[model samples]
Target: MDKYAIIKIGSTQYKIHEGDTLTVDNQNGKVDAEVLLFSDGKTTILGDPTVKDAHVKIKITGAVRGEKIVVGRFKSKSRYRKGRGYRDTLSELLIEKIELGGKKATEEKSIDEAPKKAVEAKPIKAEKKVSKKEPAKKVVKIKKPVKKGTK
Candidate 1:
């Protein structure tokens, strides 16, 4: 099947296929930039902006200035005029691949490589020596000397 993808070149949307080199106003990076987006026929939405789960990729070609256009402002009666350069910055894209659903960001680990066993949390017990601790105070005992005469 002749699969065509809709991708955003820069500020504009473009319908392109493999090995197609396209230009846009400006892109995120220079030539051979890594980009990924979802593509079909109806729309080529910005995956990052709308759907974070979307998958798409692209490569940058080069950055160049477009044709300069003269912009003039003139008043018919007052005779006032001004001119300015209008060379727009643009970038090129070499459509690498369009992932319709999303990029295979990750893969499931094999059954043999199960998740690491969680650390067995033991109850924290302060191991203080009770026998070494001394009592707060010592008590003294006094006895009366009447035991000898009472018998």
Candidate 2:
């Protein structure tokens, strides 16, 4: 509930907030490009460290250059000393808000489709056939006199 932002500048992700300035390792975006940061793609788990696709508002403070270094290739007595100034393009950002995206979509759909789902008149009652089981009848036995001799 404490308003925070998940911002992605280039391939690096940052968790930032209002007035909280942070530097990204790389800078490959415009000053204000809509970038969505997520704990994961599913849009759940804010502080799960994995983050979601929730787009946050940011104002790129400015792009800064890093330090300098020397990049020279020369022989010992050949006298070759080449120094170069290299500054990395670092972007500073201030996190504004972690937009609540799904809230509106879900709320709108639920409200609009509620009546449609309820009023979709199905059959009032289902007609099912019921068969009765009957018990099997036994045959009656009749006693017969056996012939004593070879009649």
Candidate 3:
């Protein structure tokens, strides 16, 4: 089973696996990614916000600049115009490995030594009942026409 993990860098989240290369905002140097979730194909573990004892090793490969973005402002009735352009620096990263509970995800148990424990089926929870409310109807009042001379 292929192992994978979800990690957060800055405010962005990315799903990554070992040996994967990803490009993101500049990090200046190597960063230890915060793992939000991890799955070993056979088992899945979720965190309240972030998984405990889970970490993703990342290495910064190189730095590159993003595409140029042009900004322009114009006003009518006046010959006022301004233009500007800029490029964002991006960093290329390589995913080294994912560690779950201090154990490397790449490590696998051989079939001969695999446990034969029975997998228990989890019970499904009941869905919540939502009450539907009707939208309010707008009321319009009709005004009677008054004579031109009448106050």
Candidate 4:
């Protein structure tokens, strides 16, 4: 059965399958995107705007920048010319899994993994330490007004 799905990432739509690596606009960290459509060779499902309980798990592999493009501006009969270069920031993502209708397409370790034991932590008691040195006294300053000379 075909395991392809149409998913939206940022402002772009991508047709991806399991283990597909896609480079898209820079995204912060790994994110889950909504699946717009999904097909399994014989059966196909579509979402109303977006599929309910369907999502694509993507892991951001790395960040990349496109090749620099040089832009130049000049006016006829004028010596004024300006040039600048820019690069588009891109992020590499790996399609980890796609779930349709609350069902995972890929088998995960959530169910098979052993349960973690909760460790009981003892409450710490803090004791105030008393120092043998005497506390320093604060000095108060008295301000005296200067007497004005009689005219």
Candidate 5:
């Protein structure tokens, strides 16, 4: 069973696991997030606002901009119209590990582990070109039958 926890960053709450990446409201400097709840699949711990001695370690990766939002205002019979667009500044965070009951669950690999090598890129082959030709049309001429006495 995997371990999971509910944590609060700013005013938002997120359910996260070790090694997960999160995008939330911009955090100035370091963030001291609070752990709301925690579960280790077998055991569950609840907090009255926050858990005691439990910690969730996170690293701020970078800052990002959220999707643009358009805001508009219009007043009837006033000939007044306004429109604007803006994006919220957001921050990206990586969950490093979670600690509970003096035990730590780490998502990062140890320095003794060997690093993986990058795979070599394969060359792309050119596609075969095809020429399209229009098919010939057959024309059939229909002759009206001659009237009995007229040619």
Candidate 6:
């Protein structure tokens, strides 16, 4: 059972655990932030503003730039228009560990687990077979025929 924590980095808060990777607004290099809350399914600890000596350890794995967002402005009857694009810089962080009062919550797990293989279904046998000779056409019979008589 691993403990999880909600921590604040800059202005944003994120729920994280050991070995969890997250993307946050641009940060240079590694960072350590205080935990706001901690829980391990059964037991929970809440911090007054922030927990004492509880922190999340993180390191910047990579820098990411978000897709460019286009903005446009238009005015009616004035022939006015404006266009702009914006891209935000983001930081990719790997949560190294979470500690509370000098005790580690979870151990780093290795990425050596085998991948699941998809089960192959057996092929179905074909029911109808093709033949060179033309088959006979099916004819539906009428139950009763009307007799032609002089009215």
Following a full C-alpha superposition, what root-mean-square deviation does model 6 have from the true structure? 18.5
Please list the C-alpha lDDT of all candidates, in the order they appear.
Answer: 0.60, 0.56, 0.86, 0.81, 0.87, 0.83
RMSD to true structure for each model, in Å: 21.6, 23.9, 15.3, 6.5, 16.6, 18.5
Q: Please give, for residues 96-146, the per-residue lDDT of candidate 4 as tens digits.
A: 776676654433457678899999999999999988998999999999999
Return model 2's CA RMSD, one decimal.
23.9
lDDT of 6 by residue, 58-148 (tens): 8789999988999999999999999999999999999887776764333334589787899999999989977788889999987897889
| Model 6 misplaced regions, further than 4 Å | 30-32, 103-151
TM-scores for all predictions? 0.47, 0.43, 0.64, 0.65, 0.63, 0.61
lDDT of 5 at 66: 100
- lDDT tens readout by residue for model 5, 54-142: 78889899999999999999999999999999999999999988888664332336889988999999999999999988999999999
| Clash count, predicted structure 2 | 8
Residue 89 displacement in candidate 2 (angstroms):
3.7
Q: Write the per-residue lDDT of candidate 2 for residues 69-146, one digit (tens) a residue.
A: 557666688786666666677777665445655542212354456444555767778789899879889899998998
> Residue 91 lDDT in model 5?
92
Ranking by lDDT: 5, 3, 6, 4, 1, 2
Of candidates 5 and 2, the better by TM-score? 5
Clashing pairs in 3: none
What residue pairs are clashing in model 6?
none
Q: Give the backbone clash total of model 5.
A: 0
